[model samples]
Target chain A: MHPTSDKFIPFITPETRHFWEGTKLGELRIQKCDSCGHKYFPPRPFCPKCSSKDISLVLCSGEAKLYSYVISHLPAPGFKPPFSIAVVELLEGPRLMSNVIGCPQTPSSLLLDMPLAVVYEKLSDEIILPLFKPTEKIV
Target chain B: MKNQKLVVIGAAETTSLGDIPHLSQVQLHADGALNALADAGLKISDVDGIATAGENPITIAQYLGIHPEWIDGTSVGGCSFMMHIRHSLSAITSGLCKTILITHGESGKSRIPPPEWPWPPRPGSYEGQFEAPFGTMGPPDLLTIPFLRYMEDYNITVEDLAMVPVIQREWAALNPKAWFKEPITVQDVLDSKMIAYPFTLFMCCPRTDGGGALVITTEERAKDLPGKEVYVLGAGESGETMLISQMQDFTTSRAFKTSANRAFLEAGIEREDVDHLMLYDAFAHLPIYGLEDLGFCERGEAPNFIRDRNTAPGGRLPVNTNGGGLSYMHSGMYGMYAMQESIRQVRKVAAAQVPDVKISVAHGIGGMFSASGTVIFSNQPN
Candidate 1:
């Protein structure tokens, strides 16, 4: 049987290139609808809320609250077992899926609504993945 | 479209329930369709409409030598078959086509190396570009994120979640075809190897090789059919955001509420009217969400309801009597199995039949709570 790979490499699309590129500069970029003032994630040209084409990329606070998370024991292409995958509610009011680093991947450690900050890791020259790390230092 | 005259005259699952290595995906579809046809005492030529998921409608048609006047390939996810049931009701009622055949088949466990057909997601697609990049593998990984939030918001303990699989396994014990017939306890579920946080191995549905099909036609045609008539009382389908993170609420499912509410309103029945229930149990959390979202129980009350044995066999509400996807068979998309069990209960021929089951409701979820479909069936024509 072929073993599942642990490495995760995302394809950069034209619509989402800006968000990925922003990670390289240690910034979290999101789309804001100029007409309706709706901020969203997974970059798109048009606003999903009001269907407004007038949208622009803006850097977010890079700070979030842990909305939910899971510690996956299954092996992936480039990931080790017991890695925590999380959905963090951004300070700018959007939610994104990412891994929680800089902390133990445990139910007791990964508390819900805990404060988190974005941290960038250079996967390759063209790719910079943004992950979350707990802001509160573990004793 | 309330109180439509459409009826389901035939329903049958594949000959084998689990682990058939010989049957290819296309062959499984044919096997299900043929079994459903035989159940209806009809021929392939009698089927004028065909609907399927996980494969192209044309491929199924051409392979089975069927020339359908209407075809629908609505591939949402596991709940695609439920959506097909809703769509077929409209098609048959609108005089678009008659004798609709909806089939589902997946070699989830036995098939090594995913099939190359159906093509991978486009690199530019939102899932491909965003969700897939963060090591989101499959349903187990994607759904746990929301479920974790649900557990926290509702103050549900891991032991409460374990009750889902434990109760379902109790029902599976009475089922001869259930994959795991042995009774499992809450401790067993908690002790099972953890796949994702809050989700142990038993909480996740077992992968199996199976398929099922349902045949629906007009009331007039159904009157002459050999099988018992299971009339479609009401049907509703709705979709939420595609991504789990984009969902407006993590604790409850909006799609499930919308679809089930619409179905109940169309059927002109109250929650008390349903005698049997089948909620797609692709994971243990699904039924908990289904119970609340479908209005059978209040939000944050489902875990308690299960612990009280309200959904187990002999309970007030008998759910997943076929053992569900957890203990029965989960061939990737598990909606079809749920539908089949609902039909069997309505016909009073299920292996673990609910006493006096006149009204049955089958609810399905696709993707990671991305889509929902609810269908209400009755033995008595309303």
Candidate 2:
């Protein structure tokens, strides 16, 4: 059943099924290159660093810092009025682009170098989108 | 005796830039290709290599009625065709093809009426189900983050950034082929529509439909060609990532920095040696970032340089002589035109060509400053 606020779907792609299954267990999963030891987003079968097929999925620290972000005021079809999309350079050093929730979507609100923590948005039954919110919710 | 040369023997464009309601994208591209070939006194059979950006690669091939030995269809961004010219030179140098036809065209204006892409909403994709839902359709609005960063990093005022579209509008006024030829002052740019914060409507390159092409050949073949021969000196390319959000630096284009340095070094030239610069100005703030990245100004000093009129027609450097993508026309593809402008200046054929253009740098950034291709050209054979 869908939530009154929004729905969470747990649909998974072939390459990321394991990752999603892990997220379903309340863990943030990331893949690190076994050969080069580099981490990456948009998880792939092979490591982008050294193109090594050998990689491992590991739980990640959801805490992160704001790398960059943009807020949109103009309205589009599906999304709510406005939101700030960002690249969260995870404290683990792997960068992931996700929405920063619980904050006003404005330049003044989405400060670069700001401290934030992940907030998982259960989009559908199978899909768990990780979002970020400022720790202090600083005004 | 095996050493051959690849020179730009011909170039041409549509008569004007605007909503080309009459022609399809492929037709527009073909018209430009035929015109460029005619300028070189050549025919379709003369072109063995076809490099293009955007859709309709085979349509152009069939329309021209030739099976090309090479089809360089890398849609890196607006500046890709300029990169293609460099790649074409490499192809010729490596004995891939002698006569090459490079082109850009699109009914970008008319294409808007088509339905949205049939592809499903991709959550991982920053576009579609992500940014598009929150508004951010394309170009000007999407460029807002970098626009803000430019101001934050440089202490530039909105008026200083407005100088781009304003000055470009003046140049467009002179080019009969320009889309919006109306003259605009800095006040007009600031006063125009505001799409995003700090960026007004006039400060952005408009969406339009048009086509342009260039035919390059080797120096050995340059002996018999009647058209003015422009030489390809050096080229470089770099990109951090296809996705905009993942780039390590937001205020700067990593591709632009790496590629510009590589371009100059390969050309065996220094920044001071370049006489004319053709930078892709799809967004008003782009040229400012590019200039700083290319070392035309000290870090954070591009606005001051613009204030000094360094890039204006009568300034120390003349950029975008043919109105640039801002005023001329942006058919969602500007790389070929970037190459075309450099060739025109080198050959002294542009309507606004400066008299002393020796080395010209054509810069292009694609996909949210992800892809970069830099080319340095000269009249002298290198």
Candidate 3:
């Protein structure tokens, strides 16, 4: 059996290195298209909306709303059972998949459209992951 | 081209379904192809075009001692075989090939695991960089994202979603070959172990080992064949964004609407004209989304429509009569099973046949609402 841990280390690329490093410094980095002013997640070189190559990295406020979420009871590699996997819509208008770390992984606790804030977890010296927690603790 | 009607001369699933540990994936393909050939009374030499998913068409051809003039390997997840039927129709109509064989086989349950690829996604790849890192592994994980939102947006309760499987199990009870023949109640579904939140064990399709094949040809050739001729009245396919998060709307599938609308328009019929439907039910939410997206019911009304038992056996619209993927055999891709059920219903040989079923529409979704294909079949010539 593979070792199961709660941390998942992502591969760093030239396009995503800045975003991962931003997490290390406790900043949520996203890309904004200079031409279309469209902000997006999972850092890319060009704008997915307008197909413009003129893009710049902008530090996000790290505030998001829980668009939707799932409490995964199945065992996944490097993750414990019953963890909440969420798709959070950032205030800037892009949605990204992450784990909700602070709240209980239950439907009653993880309400839809609940406000969340980004929190960084340093998995290793080279990787720092950005996960979400409720703005205030929810019972 | 509207007058150029294609027909399915033969369709057959593997000799046995669910937990066939002896056959390899390619062998399952051969099993389905040979069964379909026998069903059509045709030989390997009669097949001029071949299409398959999960396995390479060239390898299937080479293994089955077949050489084809036309081949399609459009692997867009579970709906690939549906797309194959649409593509095969065009190929046969254009004189690209005479006899087309579409095969589907998957060793989803019993196959030996292939060696893992050493390299992960390229740093810049969208899935590698964005989705996979967050432990977004497979359909169960990815599809739940949209489904959760859909439930919240529409005020759909978990009980409403459970009704989909409950009603499907009723149809499965009548199907002798259905993997889960015993009936289940809505409470049974809600109590089933949770795989993902809002998706219990019963709400998800079970992994099985099986294969299916379809033999298609021009209407003229179908007339010469002895089997009940199920005409391909219309066919349409479309795709949207690949990732679940990138979808334009979480409440509905744009691909399902586009593909099904095109199919209905091409068939020159409205939703009321159809007597039967086979919306792929890999997950319970698919049919809910499909019913609404395909215009069977209004948006946010699918849960009610299903809850009212409109899709159950003996209902106004009989859906998944051969027990859907929820209760039937789902060998990875489920489009072929849905296609087989539609053909059976049209031929009037289904285990739970609907009365006076003239037009049956089969719709398929692939890659978590990423791609869609809709094929409408009828017993009457259009």
Sorted by lDDT (best first), the order is 1, 3, 2
> What TM-score results for chain B in every one of the models?
0.97, 0.93, 0.97
What fraction of the real A-B contacts shows up in model 3? 0.63
lDDT of 3 by residue, B1-382 (tens): 4767888888999999999989888888999999998888789999989999888899999988889999999988788887898898788878899998999988877863431221244534666666665666677877767898989888989999999999999999999999999989889999999999989999999989999999998878877777677888888899997667778888999999999999998889999999999999989999999899999898899999998888987689988898899998898789999999999998999999999999999999988789999999999986
Top candidate by TM-score? 1
Candidate number with the higher DockQ (1 or 3)? 1
Candidate 2, residue B188: how far the Cα is off, in Å:
4.1
DockQ per candidate, 2 decimals: 0.66, 0.26, 0.57
Q: What TM-score does the first chain of candidate 3 have?
A: 0.90
Estimate the TM-score for candidate 1.
Answer: 0.96
DockQ, structure candidate 3: 0.57
Residue-level lDDT tens digits of model 1 in B1-382: 4445888788999999899999887788899999998988889999999999999999998888889999999988888888898899889888899899999888888873465422234546776656665777778888767998888898989999999999999999999999999999899999999999889999999989989899999888877889777888998889997788888889999999999999998889999999999999888999999999999998999999999999998899999999999999999899999999999998899999999999999999988889999999999887
Q: C-alpha displacement of B182 in model 3, angstroms?
A: 0.7
- In angstroms, the error of model 2 at B319 is 1.7
Best by lDDT: 1
Model 1 RMSD to the real structure? 2.6
For candidate 3, report its TM-score.
0.95
lDDT of 2 by residue, B223-297 (tens): 787877877777888877755666666667788899999888777789988899998988788888888888888
